[model samples]
Target chain A: MTLDTRTTVRARTATITLTGDVDAASASVLDEAIAAAAVSSPRRLVLDLNAVDYLSSAGLRCLVFAHQRLGRGVEIVLAGAHPDVAETVRLAGFDRVATIEDQVGG
Target chain B: MTAHRLVVDGLGAPSRLVAGFVSALAACAGLPPRQAYRLRLATDEITTNIAVHGYRDRGGPVDLRGRVEPEVVRVCIEDEAPPFDPTGHDPAPRVAAGPTAVLGGYGLFLALRSVDHFAYVHVGGRNRTTLCVLRCAAGG
Candidate 1:
């Protein structure tokens, strides 16, 4: 699994574009990316999953970490999650916790 | 009882490939898509559990045996590790205030939620978990 993360900060909003498979072996990269995006303490964190093909429990853990670290004011948005990963998030009831969109960008 | 066997090890291209295959087979065999995915996810979680905590990332071979019938799919996963039953295991304490508990045991919870029946037994120092899921359709 390859994880590529790029951050853009505009005003108080931060967007992190992540493209990769987020699974057990690959969650560390997600951890780092979330950490980097959180550094600016942005009010919003948009995670672009347009190219991500999968999400596992480990990946979910990484998201949970992001939620905890960012607190209430932070918005963790998952955009363009692949079918399988989206299904995982749905099945795990993460939709109640995060914002998921069909497309994501600036 | 229709039977099949599977083996898992390291160096596989995709980490969840085996899990997907297992789930796909169940889905094709008439299990509901959700149930099938659940069984496969359960297997993945246990096998991963073995590879992570039991084997400590120095992965070794894990064996899976399945008995599929018209009404149910019974799967037994065996690994060479100290005997442990995830069914009787306790879920890691919830942080409550922080992140959702990512520790462990959630897999077992998911397995229970996905399948109609489930159990685990340790035999000869191997962790053996039996998971049964009902087929949602008839004569499929």
Candidate 2:
């Protein structure tokens, strides 16, 4: 399936709301979005995965790219992850890298 | 136990979501959503590896032969790539996820780890990788 993302940067915080399945084939769309978000050097990067039905390892690799490219100063948060997606992230030992939240903050 | 088969030309996304075919077959085998997702994820990772690494030099045809067994559902992925033992690699990925962390090389680890069992063999000039997922704990 295809993945769609809506990224917005405000007040030095960047949020990328994703939808659809994030399989290997469709993960490149996510990579491009993260690249765009990185341009502004946002202090915090929030990947809202509430609408993501599936997250393959390719999607997780994109998270690694986010972490590695964003540098140590940035705080990367995975917000609103479904149980299955969250479990995969935890299984890959990525929870320690990015803070995972059930919902995006107000 | 009716078997299923699906063939895709390349590991292209959307049009040729190779794992989605396996997922559809797995769903028909009556696996739960979570298990089905894992099955799909495993297949996705393998196919991605084949596309990025194995078949990177040339285009090749990939096939999936799936069958529903009494205890588990199995999908054997067949390709013409060179001999690659997925089990040869360590299951745990070295992911520091830190400031100096170098990412990647998790495809084989994740693919083999997601499924209940996976076996690889080179026979008849084809690389056959079989992935099996348990139907249930106590049997269905």
Candidate 3:
């Protein structure tokens, strides 16, 4: 699966837009993106997964890694997650570590 | 109920194969969107586990068998690797206070939570996991 990530920082928030499937092989790309976004020390991180069709456990680990890397002060938001991805996030208890939104701006 | 089987390389990208197979099965079974998604999620988790944990990503043959019944869709994944039962394992703690908290085990945990029924067995040097998801009318 292909994973494309684009990051834009506005103010203290970094928005990372991801498209394609996030599985074991492709999770590293997301990790690098999260690391890059964390470098600016943005107070908030928004991951847009509206276009991500599939998310696996390996992908979820990348989110956990992001939460750990950004620390507690940084608010991590998962936006526009597909239904399956949302369910996996919830089941993995990611909701406790980060905020989940229906859309990026919504 | 008709059963379908698929064998894929455990070390390669199994997600696409799993998605296609599960999507077809879900469609043939008339599963709603939500149920179909759950099946796909559960299958992905188990297959990934087999590839990562069981085969250590070295590549092995993983067999998947699935069937759609009237009320539930059932799937079984079999791998001829070391015997490991995920059903008996507990999920990672929901609350991690710090970065040091262990992040492993969520794969099986999410797989368990996503399926309506989950079971594990070892027979003839094969590790088999069976998962079932109930079909709902509301499509959720």
Please give the clash total of every predicted structure, in order.
0, 0, 0
Sorted on TM-score, highest at the top, how do the candidates line up? 2, 3, 1
**What digit string (tens of lDDT, one per residue) describes model 2 on residues A44-66?**
99999999988877788898888
- What is candidate 2's lDDT per residue for B15-98, written digit by digit as tens? 246655776787778888778877877887877777667787365777878899988989898888877778886546455343
Which residue runs of candidate 3 sit more than 4 Å off their true CA positions? Answer: B92-100, B137-139
RMSD of 1: 4.2
What TM-score results for chain B in every one of the models? 0.78, 0.84, 0.89
What are the candidates' individual DockQ scores? 0.28, 0.51, 0.54
Question: Poorest 10 consecutive residues of model 1 chain A by lDDT?
Answer: A83-92
lDDT of 1 by residue, B1-140 (tens): 56777787733222466555575567557666656666766666667777777677777767878877877887887887777777666453442222354544555445555556778777777777777777763432
Clashing pairs in 1: none
List where candidate 1 sits over 4 angstroms from the true fold.
A1-11, A16-21, A48-54, A79-106, B10-14, B27-32, B92-98, B101-105, B137-140
lDDT of 3 at A58: 79
Measured by DockQ, the strongest candidate is 3
